[model samples]
Target: MSGSDGSGPAGRDHPFDAAVALKPADTGDGTYTGATHPAYANMVGPYGGITAATLLEAVQCHPERLGVPVSLTVNYAGPVADGEFTVSARPSRTNRSTQHWSLELTQDGRVITTATAVYAARRDTWADTEATMPDVPEPEAVPVTPMPDEVQWAKNYEMRFLDGALPALEGAPESPDSTTMLWVRDAPARPLDFPALASLCDVFYPRVFLRRGQAMPAGTISLTVYFHADEAVLADHGTRPVLARARSNRFGRSYFDQSACLWGTGGELLATTHQLVYFKG
Candidate 1:
């Protein structure tokens, strides 16, 4: 409801709803507009995860939504200024079981983000999981690290860090390993769904900050997520915390690559994500 012009659904009853609330306006054929809320705002723009979810929301709101998400890729072209923004989603292809969509988000008439998603009607198939869940203490065993006041997005979720944190900027030694293991879930126990799961995939802090232990200028340029579980898995998960692990493989001149794995409480691989981030030293 932050940017609603009395045209869209007034559903800010939950934080996840508030994060992806889109005000549908009759802009034209296949084009829509929505407002960004400060509740999910980041340093320079709204959180990339919420923006990604909003793009998916556009497709879900469309009358021709295909199925649940199988994979999604979002590219942050420019900063999404706080205020009204436009999102457009179009079906590129629809097959027997899978559908493909392309979307773009703009503010002030300039494209700030672009995304592509693939959704499909799943069925029983041969399944095998090779990734093992990290052996760690239970979510309740780990202490929740209070989010700093400056980060609005961090406050929306409860992050229990098992290892890796912002190193003291003063004279802190660089960590030999850049991996982090944590348990994450909505702060107020929101139900796990496709949209919420998409947002949670990006809840981890940028790998650079976690490794260097100092907040440098960094942001995700491209993010991609592959969903391994179906709707039933998420519904069964309820409000349980997800076990997540993230690590960086390479950091080059101006970009770095990081990969993360998300697992359900019963050791099911829910999703795997990778991102190329832009950073300034």
Candidate 2:
């Protein structure tokens, strides 16, 4: 797998895989251990998306996992320190067709993250999508947005903005509303998977940044993702870039809510996510 600094065998394993890799710990308590990958590091910690993926990975790797993920909610309780952390996942309840999981990530005995996940055996059922994908130019038509060198995690994805790109760091006019529409895929072109989809749900730059027209201190307090695509749908999407749109509903008291949708190349609604973010001037 590609290691930090982007040095590793090409086409062997993508950086996204390395970032979310977990090892089974010998504790025999169904726990896994993982370290932060420098390639995904943020200013104060590893990227929240990668952390969320790692937590979900723990459950996905579990021997007793019931079915594919239907929903996931991750709460960032505290900053994860830059070293090894342990994660544990347990099924709180299991029904004939669905299972509920509780997960936690800890560093030095301190709980840094907590999550809940729902997995279910899907069956054929009537379905309809009330939400429609927005009309936008194809990914080939949009130019790739250059990521800032310092933003390590941003480098992991190829982003092409259709609108609401980040504003200049200085003297940029504020936007009337926070909305970003883009096409994004893993930089090295990994296949679309649940963990990858979970990470992409967070690919949008904080809504506050787009609204204020400048960078600010902000972090996700909680994020929830609803998976609409099944394994077959994701596999069919392959490495194609996904159309994503994110916008904020309100911003006040140093907090904002962001909601987003990810659509497959075939116009299938792959996932929808909502997050609460905390920010500081």
Candidate 3:
């Protein structure tokens, strides 16, 4: 029964919303500035308009707390360059357990991106589900690997893939559709807040999706994350490889489908996700 306001969704609860926008084009190297959009401070990445999940994360992705994402949507029509830009978020709906929101990205007076997201408290019923995480290699056992040029954020976390783009692996088959399996954790143990937790998902934009020989940096227009009940128990699990799986429903020049999952290495199901991505030229 929750919905949006006429202008932008009015905040019914929470104070995590932010505003960002881009500044005048700089001739220094034809790059974007953060002065125009401070919300997008990660100058190294595509930084597509902040996704819907971010809006929700601002309110819910706190570590050492209890929260879950039901859905996240992002409509990216413009790019937030290195230049300064502005972004804002507001709640459109909030029920007993669920909350919804809308956000925007702008540059030099022009609107380029929009998004919506939903969050909910993890429920007790989910604990009974049987989604299991497959056994995997320990983080310490694997050699340290360099982060991908485009996936610079990965440097902060340790990762291992249960099912990567290897040409051959038992049961690990290839597909034209995009998908992937990986494990990630921040070194030195950062606070597991919603923003930090969501940052893990951030490294997994649609562009990073790969299947068989299919791999690309997927910039999502929309993203939806579903907490699989036991996510709160992630700490009980070690830094071992967790179960992760992703898939794409569609892929196009301007649009695509994406999703992912996170679970305990012991086969305990934790969370699953889906996202819609919009690419830039």
Task: Assess the local accuracy of residue 62 in candidate 2 as a C-alpha lDDT between 0 and 100.
Answer: 92
Candidate 3 per-residue C-alpha lDDT over 87-185 given as tens digits, one digit per residue, 9 for 90 to 100: 555566767777666656567778766666666775555335454555657655655454554443444556665555333323444556555566666
Highest lDDT scorer: 2
* Candidate achieving the largest TM-score: 2
Q: What is the C-alpha RMSD of each candidate to the true structure, in Å?
A: 3.5, 3.3, 11.0
The lDDT per prediction is 0.85, 0.91, 0.50
- Model 1 agreement with the true structure over 207-255: per-residue lDDT tens digits: 7776676778999999999999788998899889999888999998999
In candidate 1, residue 200 scores what lDDT?
A: 85
lDDT (tens digit, per residue) of candidate 2 on 226-281: 99999999889999999999999999998999999999977899999999999997
Better of 1 and 2 by lDDT: 2
**Cα deviation of 172 in candidate 1 (Å)?**
2.8
lDDT of 3 at 157: 56
TM-scores across all candidates? Answer: 0.93, 0.95, 0.62
Score candidate 1 by lDDT: 0.85
lDDT of 2 at 195: 94
Candidate 1 lDDT score at position 211: 68
Q: Which ten residues in a row have the lowest lDDT in candidate 1?
A: 3-12
Q: Candidate 2 — which residues are off by over 4 angstroms?
A: 1-12
